[model samples]
Target: MGTSVGPSAGLSPKYQRLIQRTLRIERQPKLELQNERQQKKNTKSLVSDLDGKLSSLQSQLSTLTDTTSSPFDGRNASAAEGTEGFSVSADETASTGSYSLAVNRLASEDGRVSQTFDADKSNLSDFFTNNGAQTFSVDVSTPTDSNPDARTSIDVTVDSDGTNNKEVLSDIQSAIDSAFQSAVDDGTLSADQRPSASVINPTSGTARLSLRSQQTGYQGRLSFSDSSNNLLSELQVNADQIADDTQGGEITEVGTDEASSKLTSEFELNGLTFTRNSNEVTDAVDGVTMNLEEANGTASSFEVTADEEGAQSVVKNFVDRVNEVITFLNEKTNVNPENGERGELADDSTFRRLSRQLRTDATRPVEGQPEGLNTLADIGIEANRDGTLKLTDEDALRTAVRENQGALKDLFAGPDGVATRMKERVDQYADTGGLLDSRQDSIDSSIDRIDDRINGLDERLQRREQQLREQYAEVESTIRSLASQQQSISQRLF
Candidate 1:
């Protein structure tokens, strides 16, 4: 049979598919490079996590080594029955012992108030001293302290129509409060030591003004006077009314006056007499700051003891941090058997060495412990099958700390200790110019090269496509020409 060819017949489909398949094959290396870059990124992130754990452990270890924060040197104070008002805090230098404490009295400040007046009716302006003087002064007695000036006298000037308006009782109170408030804002007077004023029985014509001490002790008593005015007399403030009040006296014409008198605080500590300007006693006992609340007929006492719970908490934290890093490393360096999925760092020899070193350091004995308890297991921390650690017995750990405090501090903070070695190990991978950084850089470079090669392949494929299209068109033209010639010959023969 004679064969007839269709005009629509074109280049073979397999030929077109051949180059596309080659392009896919060419892209395989780039895809691999992208995946490797991702893996390196994951490894770097895990390294940072491990570094943080190491840093935390180091910080915790510092608490045990520092002379100011050592748990072995820590002490806690407890108030006995009826002694709850006073609380205490101690540092590492605090000596451990029990002492009987008594709150004989708390410190206090001086307070004073002016005599009442009928603002609308009484002629209160006539109370001023002889020479139209409207100023007054207060004498304060706090045990003279070197710093803070403990200003002995405060000057209060009346705010009025400048000697024209008739001043009332409330006007004087406002002026006094204004002066004290200014002192407080200037930092000269402490908030607790600042004076306050209030109007008692306000509506009554016989309303009285009262003042009390801000500091709770006797040294805080206050007395009032005016160099040439009757300000103190009008306010009914006298030395006897304030319990321990004293004021300047013998004011000469435009000259100075006598010095003010002050008082002190008295109390008993453990039947030993102690005196202080203020009721808060700090130096009486080492590392103990006692704030006396009140005097009681029955004596109150408290005790100081070693803090075992604090020490145990520190050790437990150490164990958990160790387990966290170890477990993370193990997970990152291992392949899941069920899924057969390899981890990012599964075949990395450097990470493998690090993982193995981590295991050894955690379980191995440290070189510097004097009691031969060099390993974490000696302090009740032990590793499990899955590379995690647990506190096997908490009591045993506490006993180790209390019995061997010096040894524990040396064991963790010493030259060849677990924390020191682990810190160095983390630095190898996580620090700048470390292995992890270099590995990331290498992967990044490979990915960049893969991208460049991909672009090059695209350009090459475009050129090949252009050449193939031209050759196909030529072949088609020849086939069409041969068919036309055949058709002409057949028609003539017929």
Candidate 2:
């Protein structure tokens, strides 16, 4: 018998796979589209980064452009040692000057304490009718500039079954607090018009109830009377006790002058005497607040001046933001020196032009400014070699902020000022519907189109692959027919 060829002959499966892979590799359009998509994505990322930097720059610009309540208007109050009678603070509206203060009296809050009671032995229910529930009223008077005698009253009902004096006092204290707090919540009484109640056990055997005003000075004075029961008289904290105490009686009165009953803060500012209802006086001096701590009756010297450091901080922060935006633009638009590859935004004309314009805006001199305080260079901010800004001369900036504030304002906030012009330019590119947003939208659309094209290419590859498989199937059939014929011929010849 002669040897016969098998039907599984000709092209091997491994070679067929190699040929299909070669054909797929030659489809260059899909690979090119993928590369383009990556480039666009990088460009979009750079655009987002630049947009964030521009927004930060705009916020810093707004602080400089604001006409009212700016850092330029800041003021500071300074006092020497041994002037411990009062602490002072000045605002933007305060004038730069020296002030002399002498404190005669510091305002105080009104308070009252009941006579001591033997907690274990005393039966506080006797104040009521044989330990029955008793209802009494509390009157709080908070005087104000508009109303000298604003009084509010709240009635509290206490039910105590205990014979211990401390426990009964605690019940009364809780009732009083609950009543006033409820009045405050219902808008019947303001918070300052409410009084605080507490029961203090100074000794193990003795306990006393104390009530204090929420406010300082005479505005917080309090008085108690019996509403349905003689609670205040029995507690020995009524107006009669207060009067007798004020007239050299045993019950001591806190926060009230024995001679005049004038619970006010009396101090002399700038050699002129003035009195305020509260120790924290704000209106006595324009834009200056004086907080009285002691009644030393000694003069203290305080100086109010422009806040140079505050103004300098504002300027430095503005410069830092400007540098950030400028540096980002430069980096995104730069070209690599080694391989000559363009950066993410190298071809973006808007960002390229913005980079140059920012440098010009940051360095150019403002019109109508004086010789020494005209430009950013004059006020200590200078451009670096790469076009970023730096605060180089702090002393010059400080002098400009303190002595030449008007000219400095003109340099940063005027019509043709550096900060003003830079802000306008950045807004055109970063604001809503601005150039950067439009560019990003256009890039997104292009990416979407690329995705569609890639999908079409994938479908075309699949169809081509199917056609190649059919052609290879025909070749396999022909090989099988030849192998069967050879086997038949060998048998016939034999």
Candidate 3:
């Protein structure tokens, strides 16, 4: 039992040629394994690409299916001409009606400015003789309650670090913000109750401390008071000019606050009166927020209507994603132009089914919608000859949405809608542990097996090569000894 092949009885055996032939035969399996590995890699990549496109299509479909979001219930609003002081947002709850808005006085924040000083040169030592806790309080009066009576007044104390004027002002601002935030945290004051503080250096080359009510309108009127007169006076803020809620006044300009007493914003809508401390009123209308931009006593008309931009965007995205998936399927399944090589999943049946399913879902008519609104075609979306979805007429779609939004909504995202069905179908191919996942796992496993066989073959080939070399070396030595013996015997005979 010889372990190796025939060794030449001549000068030496042709071991190189034998090893080459044997190795060539043995490496066939390894070569095949490598090719299979590459094919599997390409297949996995194809599946992965399909998965991403399908997932995106599903997400877009989800947006259309979630009817509770009122995806089609968009709102648009506009103020009457010559109106500069207000804006509005109309939602699902807003009616298709116009309102005559008369702003008796636009709500303004209780605001005040500091007397001026030189920012670079001034220090806290000039104002406060002692670097201790100095207290400042904010008083707010609403229709229900007035502050400075403890509950409505937010008191904050600033601890002077005995630093420069800039640091002093900054510390004061920080302390005020912290106090309000603490109140909000403790449920003492609402988040909106916070006051704002800033250091203003006007052209006077002097720095002044500016303080204002964080809130707007009459209730947000600010009144500044210091238990220590030195605090307000040194800061150069006028404590005497507090705004009184009883006197309603309008500012001719934006920044000029004549008094410390801030005026509450007063406005009338549809002959109904409304009063708020701030110009920005959230509760004025149901599902509608009112921002009193200006107080024009004259009637300013605003109309609330549906905003179609959001719904239109969602619709556009759905079409684009459908086309993307179609393009991917077309390219992957077709042969490459440059090399004439087919794609990894060119004959993939599962991918073919997935592509056909998506197109069918998009073209299918939604159940329960009107005959004119049930299908994607009815909503101005049509399939082209190339099997791609196209919004054929944007104006028609927009008109459809504007006129019968409910019908369009039902067709796209209703219980038996096109988007919903498409999403569900996509899930079969792209979801976790779904068809694509199974396919990818199978590919990865094949690659793993090929790698194992290739490694084993590598070890076997190395051993076989060494054995051939050793056997041929021994054959060469034997031939050398035989030739020497024959030559010596012939010489003696002669």
Candidate 4:
């Protein structure tokens, strides 16, 4: 057979080379698989860290939402029971009894009564007797013609040469204008306070400056004086002259004895006032006391006891809290700070379901009320399309709070009230073994097991790689020894 030196003889070398190359490639894939497994482990750890932070934030948000949205605040029925459907009587008053009755009235300033009728003999006599020797200074100058057709007029100037006399007319006008502006700004000025100022220059060349005080029964006239207290102007009159002037004059009624009362029950504890036959109460005068009478001819002895303000405040605070919760949830669940992306919580099935449940709870009807009392709509609270609460009608809310406070209380304080229900639900989900806790625990356990498995795999892979390296080294040594023998033989043969 001549030692069969065919292709089979060379195939051994090629087959060994192929096996070595295949081993190298297979080792590379094992290393790559190890890297991929490690990368997966790192990703899982990152997800766990993020989930922990998110769970913590959600817990905090849940606490805040519960605190701010508590429907139990101001739900106490004590104040309502004491205030509603109650009538008070002034006859129940004792001289020193510590009795308090809330009366509704208009708020006004305090001041002297408005003056009227300056021509009465007794009034004029009293005015001049007490106001004699009061002086005023008058300086009249010829008016420069602004219009040619207009009659020649006289102008009055005060201390024209003195340093303090600069723009005296302008200063006076400014003062008057400022006073009017102030009255307008205060929102309390009445018609009686709208007084006008005028400067008169009689043909006698005497310039008279007068301030007609907006008051009734003026017992004295005004006196004008110089800076040095010297009398500048005064009206001289005897008792006989005053009496004759009073007798000759027409009886003019300048002011009336109208009673002014305002009703302030809506806004404040202050009672309303009734002004008899006159609108003087609307004047800008401060602290003018008219009779404080009720519209029904009764004394100010009405008692309106209700928790209206407190209830409304509670509802408002609750609505505000709920909105805050919504905002917080939206931020936490949907928004990603890095990429500006929405978070898992933003449209989370659990969160949306809970929000809808809360809304239904809030708007649920009161028990024993056939017409379905105590809805959010009744108190002017409306829900937006985004599942948030809004206050739309403040007046209507106030009225509902005032009138149906009991129903309002029951709506939130009843067995199925929003507060109670929310507390139960939140507590259930937030408990140690609750939904969030269970999920987190499960994830933690999974991570722990995965870490254990990865650690075991790492140990096994290290041992396997060491053993494979030793085996390859032994194989290379044997192969190299055999090749050396073959080379030596060939060299000897050559």
Candidate 5:
């Protein structure tokens, strides 16, 4: 047998694989395209990070710029140690002052209990539904007599099918609650003036109806009258159980005489006494709300001061956010001097420009600020050598917040101020359709283009590979035929 020179003559599986491998070498070089894509992905990631930092910095600045809610305008109220009977708080409008406070009484809600009835045996529905009368009305009057006619009335309808005392009492309670809630929803009754009814059923004993006013103190006194039925009379809760419903159909008293003291809050501020119908008193002092928890005869000192710590915290947070943006830009835009290694964004001029703008705005003096309160440096927020902020002198910041808060706020949050300008600049990059978005879109488009080019190159390479396979097959067949003719001639000559 003679050796054949066809493509399959020595083309074992291993040899065929080698040929295929060699053909793959002729395919397009995608290393550069792949590297470019990776670089673009990295840039996009960095840009996203930059966008996030800028957005955070802008949000921190917004808080400072809002005059109505500026942290610098905040106030704090502090009561002297060992002070009794009260807790107090102050808002931005509170005056910074010291005053003596004394609480004589804490206001309470008005409540009344009906006569007891058998829990399971007594049937209240029969009494209430007499003469087909199944409806009742309740009135809640104002604490002051200035407007005697100023009262709210709610009508309750009883459920007729209730069988026992407890069931009937529960139905009446539900009806009353529904009526009052409906009045509130319909704007006929104020929520504070709405009364409540409950069926008080004790275990192994009798049941009773409990009527209470939601409003604290005298304002919460309740009165009952027959509308379509004598529901209150049936329960024995009317006619001076607490007090007779008089004074033009409004009950002036609903609780026992001893409980009357709890109907109004009494306190003294700066030796001047005051009384109110609520334990939480907001009108005694401007911008100050005091909660009288209990009554103590002794007076105690309370101080209202500027919330320097709160303002400091806001300032510190702003500074920290600013530093984060600055630091991120610095690191990404930095180039190592020793190794000449470039950062992710070192070649981008936009980030470098933003970094400079942020640093300049943070450190620059304001246009209209007074000399003593001109710059952040004056308030102890100073720039480090690397353009980051540091709270160098916390005491200085506190003093500024304590004494010159308005000017300090103006320095950072005022119109054309540091935070205002920085925020405006950041918005150009961080907002939708802004610089970062545009840059991201451009990078994505470039990546798409590269992918398209790679795909085209691959298609061309696949076609070329197929052509080479056909050409190699033809060459192998010619070689095998020539070798066969040479073998026949050699054998005939032998």
Candidate 6:
């Protein structure tokens, strides 16, 4: 029942060698696993970059295809040909301009006077009020026959102190000037637009500030009040009368042809008066009503409506967008960046083919049209010597757009449009079953296999490490037994 002494006292050299060999095997697999993991990471990164590039190219190609097939530029030949029967002249009604507006200032229920101008009828009170209460009031009006110089007065009263008063007045003046300038800038008003406001005083007082219209016939009155309905009433004299008295008509151009003509012409919108000779046209019998010049020719009878202008602008923008897309694609594929390299998709045969295809698709002829109307060239979009398209004849293009609008819309906007075709092509190359998709699939599969292999290697390495430890422990025990046996034999011999 007693425990016997073992011959092995310590680990033998043979057992140590066996343990070392097992450890070497275990470490070998771990090193291999590390290398495999690094390789996997590098491979994944490479695949990811490639995938991104592929996706980008696919998107670009899709966009190009869509644009190429889009109805934006595509027109039905028959529709284009039909447009030849109609003619549009720039001198026609399209060239004529007219605006109608009504302006008036009324005392609000609270005794605050509010002014409104134009069709939408914007209230000047909004510009000068807070919470629907006027903080200050301005009176710009021309005097009656009793006060010939009354038009020269514009009384501004500031209920608030500090820069707010000055700022508000300045803003009002600016707004008035801007309104007049806008008409001139848009070519709707002549340079002789008669009214111009002049600030008399910039400080707070009775008639603290005033604006005088440049013309004598411009006799309009305005009144200002605060939110509390308190009136800061002031009188303004006719500027012409004032000038005649002070400078003997030297500053007054009332009788001149320019002034007279300006006075006679008024802006009307939908039969409503908007402005007359640069002054807000009003219904009051006090002011003279001016007549517009009659159109001189039959062509002048035709009018270019807002809708027509909008359509023309839309077409132009579409063409510009197409040109931009073409330029972008060309630069990406053909031109090298400043760094002396092309895009990822550069030098790709597919991209080159796609570009050519897009061009071809864009320029393809439609059926059922006259020879001249078969291609974009008939409508004035001609191919340049450099292979790009340009609008050589704007009139022809416009006519085509007007006459064959439906056909043109179909060609570019229909299901078979250049944009649609381009999108299909790009999607084919970039989709799950596309060229890039196949490559990605292969790479993914390889990654999966590699991962599985690494996993197996990991498990094998762990098992081998554990086995080595166990073997080393056993070897140490055997050596201890051997040493004990040797010691007992030695003692017995002695």
TM-score of each: 0.77, 0.82, 0.72, 0.38, 0.81, 0.36
TM-score of predicted structure 4? 0.38
lDDT tens digits, residue span 378-459, model 6: 6666655434557677776677566665555444444664435545655665567776566557656776776787678767
Worst 10 residues of 2 by lDDT: 243-252
Deviation (Å) of 50 in candidate 2: 1.1
List model 2 lDDT by residue over 276-387, tens digit each. 7688999987999988999999999999888998998899889889889888888888898999987678887888889999999888888877797778999888899888
Displacement of residue 484 (Cα, Å) in model 1 is 5.4
Name the 10 consecutive residues with the lowest summed lDDT in model 3: 245-254
Q: Compared to the true structure, candidate 3 yields what TM-score?
A: 0.72
lDDT of 5 at 440: 99
Lowest-scoring 10 consecutive residues by lDDT in candidate 4?
A: 233-242
The reply for model 3, stretches above 4 Å from the true place, is: 1-14, 80-83, 111-212, 221-262, 271-273, 334-343
Q: Give lDDT: candidate 2, residue 40.
A: 88
Pairs of residues at least 3 apart in sequence or in different chains that clash in candidate 2? none
Residue 125 C-alpha lDDT in model 5: 57
Estimate the lDDT of model 2. Answer: 0.79
Best of the two (3, 6) by lDDT: 3
| Candidate with more favorable, higher lDDT: 2 or 3 | 2
lDDT of 1 by residue, 1-494 (tens): 11213432355565446545765676576577567656656666765666676566556655544545566556677777656546566555567666766555444455454444554444455544334547887655434457522545678887443221124555666777888888779877667766666555545344455555565444455656764556667556543443222232211111111122233344566787565556567778888777665666346677766667787777677777767667777877788999999766688878778777877767778885765578878877878987677888777767766667677766666678776676677667666777766776776676677667756766765665555544655667787799999999999999
Which ranking of candidates, highest lDDT first?
2, 5, 3, 1, 6, 4
The total number of steric clashes, by the backbone 3 Å criterion, in model 5 comes to: 0
Cα RMSDs of all predictions? 7.2, 5.7, 7.9, 18.4, 6.1, 16.4
Task: Please report, in order, the local distance difference test score of every candidate based on alpha carbons.
Answer: 0.62, 0.79, 0.72, 0.41, 0.78, 0.43
What ranking emerges by TM-score with the best candidate at the front? 2, 5, 1, 3, 4, 6
- Among the numbered candidates, top TM-score falls to 2
